[model samples]
Target chain A: MRIKGYVFTLFFVLGVIQDSVDGRPLLLSLSRPHPDSAADFARWLVSQNSWGVLNTIASDLGGAPFGNVVSYSDGLPNKGSGIPYFYLTTLDPTASNALKDQRSSFTISEYPIGTCGKTDPENPTCAKITLTGKLKLLDGNSDEVEYARTALFSKHPEMKDWPKGHNFQIFKLEIEDIFMINWFGGPKPLTVKEYLHIEMNKVAFVV
Target chain B: MRIKGYVFTLFFVLGVIQDSVDGRPLLLSLSRPHPDSAADFARWLVSQNSWGVLNTIASDLGGAPFGNVVSYSDGLPNKGSGIPYFYLTTLDPTASNALKDQRSSFTISEYPIGTCGKTDPENPTCAKITLTGKLKLLDGNSDEVEYARTALFSKHPEMKDWPKGHNFQIFKLEIEDIFMINWFGGPKPLTVKEYLHIEMNKVAFVV
Candidate 1:
């Protein structure tokens, strides 16, 4: 019995260690809010994910909706403000497109956060959020830029080292609408005000 | 010496086993194509990923670009046709939006595939591709729907069991343009013709 117990503990520890090495969040990190808590669930999905698709109206493509995979931060770790900030370079079409037309959306999925285990990403229950509004570039000297830079660099450290010649600048989604699906029966009705005002204490991270 | 050798072998086996369990691809599975091979690299990105952000012109949202997390498959396993197929329900805005306007883009990233390896997902070297074109709903009785169903089901097994009342239907992206970035440079100039013709023999999966 002692030997069996020892073997079980060893395997458990190994599993946790391997999960960390693979960059997957353990169950403790995935403290999902109940689906009924629409605003909280939307905040949870955005805060947990590090990257998402940033869509823009591409003028070059005859006003087609162009989506690009990009990294973004809502805030630092557990202190997300429900507003997504992005570090974009004009060299990329997304930024350039946004310059031409500020209307855009940022979409993130819970699948990559490891909370929607075994569920297809497209599955209604898997949880996906789209923040729709104007994508505006912030003035470099603004205090919001400082906060956004900190939020972005903390999550994506490599951003600090990106070439200055590329002219990377801070851009944020001025969220006017929120479309989130954490369960069936269509997207939950979540207003931008409701999403932005959700207190952090209401939906605490388990880890 | 014999004890040390045994310990090393045990840990190595455990690591591999844990990686498999975690669903992170073993290093052997990540055979990246040279960044210079635009068509090959683009094809590999689409083939390896089972999900992406499918963007569409949202007529309801003042014609703003809307992106949604979606599961898609090009074909079964290693036999992708370079055209992505999706099983989406009109209950979702993405499918309904596509019906109103065909202009859309499907974007996928290398980050989720576990090959980016410590690189920020937004890092240019990490690779991201957006296939820009029309998102068309295929006829239920079309032969292409059969192929798409097989491809989508093989990748996302849970999709097969989704509620029938939701009315999931087949949709395919008629890729008119290919935008991919695999290295520290601007978008690779990959025409749709070049991307569609890249034979499987040229870029074989390592695993």
Candidate 2:
């Protein structure tokens, strides 16, 4: 009785802390799709995650693959576009690299999503997805840029207050291939067409 | 004092949950190094994080960069070598890609380490690092392999119980260049030699 009250209070406090720390509220409402539902699972992974390693070719380093930590959004909450958009500046190597080569990949892990309970991050049961494609910078005047900005700012409110002198612009990964491993059988057979078209009805509302 | 008792009990329960989910004890002891201490900060980020995205060139996908979620360790707790070691299998594309081309990079984020407080993961204050180097697979008979396996299994206990036929091997990133942004000034200028040679005496105990 009293113990239950304490537990609830604790969780509430922890929830608030997590929300503030992560810059968005905890994803409590959306249920994880079964591993067999590859398209849904892939889309859910992208939409649920706030940040991932965005890989680009570093021409200065003899064209080695360079992965940079960056925040991204597919859309606003449940309204995901299945395409990741970023707010980047030329001051960073990731944006600079993309301008020269454009070949890139973005990787997200289910580990940080707080769902892979007691599972080793490398364990095949833990979900991970990589969207491989050309990283294209969006035009300043495009309607897509407007939609992407809303998506980015809603998730990361501090982004709106960033330094104007940095010349932050929108860049998105034009996914050409998908690589995901959620179960023991190996990489799931998923295509870009399938991933982009899957209806996210099962994801529920974002809390 | 009743409120204090409830808060304590709640935190105790949550700590257990976080430890199990992360597959290691919560890092509540060690203090974060100042961002100006680039070498210490970089080493601390690598040592504390258990998982990251390792990027490689996907030969099958026209040599586009491929990033995969992976588990890694620098050394046994508090005895870090400042070099990232990974347990990889050829079944995964990261290991397969590394074999074809050793040019790769491993990225780690301080966000997962839970010390960034309310900072956004992409914010400069929330440090991130990319170690551009060759991902070399160690020989089976090498003494270094023995050290690496100890480093890996200590942090991730379930690796020992993994399926025997999977044939997981040890791999290390021979870091040549370091790109880290821990504060407002942009990427810190750090070299591989300085990063490896820095004394980790300030990190304190593992608990």
Candidate 3:
């Protein structure tokens, strides 16, 4: 128990320190850049005004992919790539049914509306970048619970009136995967390889 | 094989017809909307912007949810109810690696930039949405490959010479499960039930 307590304390400290990095994933499955590069990516995200799509694996029903959309709040840690945080409220029977059947994955994609010919509104091309993570529904306020909520709302003020109940569940996603799309071409398609090495270079993600 | 095709085609036809009403699952998951709700939802998606997050579950893979930001050019067979229908290119090693390890769940969420608050240059709240589906990679069209080159420029224009080889590797997501975010409040969070009800009442999606 003592060792556990010590470990808990260490984790707590690490979580707080992690705040310094914002909500960016502490451990990404890919390459990590220098602190400067990390900072560059974070600043770019805010400046770009990019929205995030998060992907997670739901619990299950036979074998199929279940997914949901939730908005991401990038301001929590404030450093940019800090922690990828967001808030979502659902009352749909379909979502509830899916949730009941299995956990869901969220894909948060950010894009530059103007740059990708999305400026006209009549015909828009959106450039996208995605983050991959795992989400767990939270019970009540505990250590991680509070952190998640605080981090979420700090960035998205619109979520201020959402209720707190078993109905208004909170999901926590452990960051895992990250990808960005090079969508400069309007309808013309690009390969996954070109996507990574070419168009995506502008986004300065944690590559 | 012919008989099996016939049966599958029958199911396909029935599903296409019942899209909006029943939310039928099909090979191209984001193929279309339920007949009844097709027009309304299509209008909504256009008004709300077709660019949103799609949350999906790889029911086969422990209900893993995946979210991808996709470009939607509906007017296809069944393109309403906001079912995703498009192409995506991902070269991220992590994403490819993840696919090798497991199937994925995906989701896409959409939010109006200024719906909740004011969106200005300094204070920007980006509009969002997603396409959640099973993922796989593919190459770009031979004729249009050059323009699709990301090596030219991260932005829309080109910088220098184009890269060689198959421009795109490929990442195609056949969607099965999905949900869109209905965020109109602050921190309190809206329940999916309420959101879905609003969507249903506002429009008729059932075939």
> Of the candidates numbered 2 and 3, which has the greater TM-score value?
2
Candidate 2 C-alpha lDDT tens digits along B1-207: 797656543432232112222434545434566677688778878877889999999999888999999999999876689989999989889999999999999999998777676788999999999999999999988999999999999988889888789899999999989999999989999989999997665434434
| Full ranking by DockQ | 1, 2, 3
When superposed on Cα atoms, how far off is each prediction in RMSD?
A: 9.2, 8.9, 16.2
Instruction: For candidate 3, write residues A1-207 as lDDT tens digits.
Output: 797656543432231111111122332211221122223332333323434544433344334344433445433433333344445445533234434543434343334222222331112223344444455566575776677666566655545554555255556544444333333333223232332232223322232
Q: Tens-digit lDDT track for model 3 on B1-52?
A: 7987666434334421211111112222221222223233233433333344
Model 1, which residues run further than 4 Å from truth?
A1-30, A201-207, B1-30, B201-207
TM-score of 3: 0.45
Cα lDDT of model 1 by residue, A6-114, tens digit = 6533432231111432254533443566687787678877876789999999899989999998999988876788899999999999999999899999999887776
Give the deviation of candidate 1 from the true structure as CA RMSD.
Answer: 9.2
What is model 3's DockQ versus the real complex? 0.19
Candidate lDDT scores, in order, read 0.82, 0.84, 0.36
Chain A TM-score by candidate, in order: 0.86, 0.86, 0.47
Query: fnat, candidate 3?
Result: 0.43
Interface RMSD of every candidate?
A: 2.1, 2.2, 11.1
User: What TM-score would candidate 2 get against the native?
Assistant: 0.88
Worst 10 residues of 2 chain A by lDDT: A12-21
Please list the residue runs of candidate 2 whose C-alpha ends up more than 4 Å from where it truly belongs after superposition: A1-28, A201-203, B1-25, B201-203
Backbone Cα, N, C clashes tallied per candidate: 0, 0, 112
The best-first sequence of candidates by lDDT reads: 2, 1, 3
Candidate number with greatest TM-score:
2
> What DockQ score does model 2 reach against the true complex?
0.46
